[model samples]
Target: MFDSATRRELYEFTRGTEKFYYTSGDAEVELNDVVYEQITISRSEIKNSSDLEKDPLEITFARDSKFAQDCLRSALEENVYVKVIKFQHGQQSILWQGRVVSVKPSGASIVLKSETNFTKLGRAGARLKFQRTCCHDLYGNGCRLNKADWGVQTTIKSVTANAIELRDLSFDDNYFRLGMLQSAFGVSVGIESSAGNTVNIIRRLDSLADQITSDADLLAYQTAVLELDQTIATRDALDENDPNYEQDFADAQALVDQKQEAFNIASESVFFVVAYPGCMKSLTACDRFNNTDNHLGFAYMPEDNPSTTRNA
Candidate 1:
């Protein structure tokens, strides 16, 4: 209760299955044997507003704290749920709940900008539209696709700018287009296109870039590229009239593929799981997933509005 003199504030930050508990006190607080580490944490006042603009809660953590380091490492882009609780004696009551929308690193502290459910409700968008494509989200209620069936577990083979190569995917090219690539640490990147084992991401993944930059195999890929080029050049110089030219060219091509495969395997250090996104078109829904029955699109919808169209 607010009237209690012994009341303290407890903060809980959650990202996927991971949770961090902290308290703004002189020492750590133990509740049910779980320790909430003492940290310099504070949040802005929650307010009510009539406008649609978000009323963000700015939560700050000490720059040097372990939680701040975690935030910098991966939590900046991921959705982190924040809960504030008022604790007195052995009782606890939730004071605020929200999901982090953005993060700012100040000179002395890391600040998280978060918003409540009301912000989502106030967002400007029609809930549904009269379009030819499906209105439902992939793997959502109306789509009714099993996400687990579409997921593929693989390791990072290499990364070049916004493109990432994973263990060879047997699926056809563009199978993962408009899909998601999630790292073992829960950082997710959107897939723009996929071919063979390589995926082109919609945006740069800073966390993954940092990891690949320091990896020892970064140089290995460069060396592999040079070796592959040399092999191709040697194959191209072969004379067609020579008796052993065919065998020589085949051997050279084989070596190139082998070297490239080895290079991909050598660079494997991090694990990632990718899943294919559902198609919005009715024809794709039927041809790809054989899920025409659950298709939410109005494929036969008229191009012109019935109410507005008239014979000239």
Candidate 2:
């Protein structure tokens, strides 16, 4: 067994070595092959805390490239997951893992803030499940709970870290019963599903749990496929003076004239937006794998467990 001081020294030595990996979402985690560019790790630590007031970890880092910036930005906007790992001399450990909550500009660099996935579960409008989470709760040690004699089946419409949106309980005494259950067990109200198969359990995808084995090859798939946005209309019908005019001066004017004539003739054609959802590996891409397509597509993945709905 490695001593505590020896482990600390090993970690310091590894920091001075070469590089680390930052992957988005819970995909395949490997020591090699899937490694992206070498990243600079500034600060990383996990503090053991039984004290309720303090967080169990403190981690922060900076990525100088625009690709990293874009990836981090997309993660923050979509609430996607991210992880940083280091491997050396036959030993590897996860340095930090969390959902990217914020990405901000710091001078010429980009700053990323990742909180434990549980923290994201606490955000307003988060979906909740009654029985277990996608992966183990980082701070809660998987939030493993034994079934007790008492059981409650409450529909959780929404949740924040501290509170949950429950149905049918507010008017009835079930709310008080829930509060009593919380007081007795010190468990989060939205942790587990009941044994009966009546209500819908919350579905969560946690990439960090040992029970959840993700396909390594599929994990590398990155792209956030945006919903086909008809939000912006095609500019084919725009006049030169139109604010949304996209074509050149002559072409725009010609199109406007054509549109007017077409309207008089009752044209059967409908204009389609030629916009292609942006792809990564482009000049504007951050990490090649961190793009809008992957984030949007991930939403369609089936829930981790079968107790709840398949695709929500």
Prediction-by-prediction clash tally: 0, 18
Q: Pick the candidate with the highest TM-score.
A: 1
lDDT of each: 0.71, 0.33
Give per-residue CA lDDT, model 2, range 1-312, as digits (tens): 223232221111111232334433233234346434334434445554544224333333443443344444233333345554544355667665555455555543455555664554544765534331132221111222212322343333333433333333323222132121121112221222221211212323121111221233112211111111111123333465866455454564565565555453331221111101112222122122233232222223445564544332
Stretches off by above 4 angstroms in model 1 are 1-8, 11-29, 32-44, 48-83, 88-94, 97-128, 206-283, 305-312
Total backbone clashes of model 1? 0
Candidate 2 residue spans exceeding 4 A from truth: 1-30, 50-63, 71-75, 121-123, 126-312
**lDDT by residue (tens digit), candidate 1, 1-312:** 134458888988898788999998777788878788888888888777775355778888876565665565343545688898988866899888888877767766788888875677867753567666766656655667787787887667678988987775888888888777776566565689988988898767656654433235645655776777787788788898999988988998898788778767755643455545535355465458777777666666654676552211
Q: After superposition, how far is residue 190 of candidate 2 from its true place, in Å?
A: 40
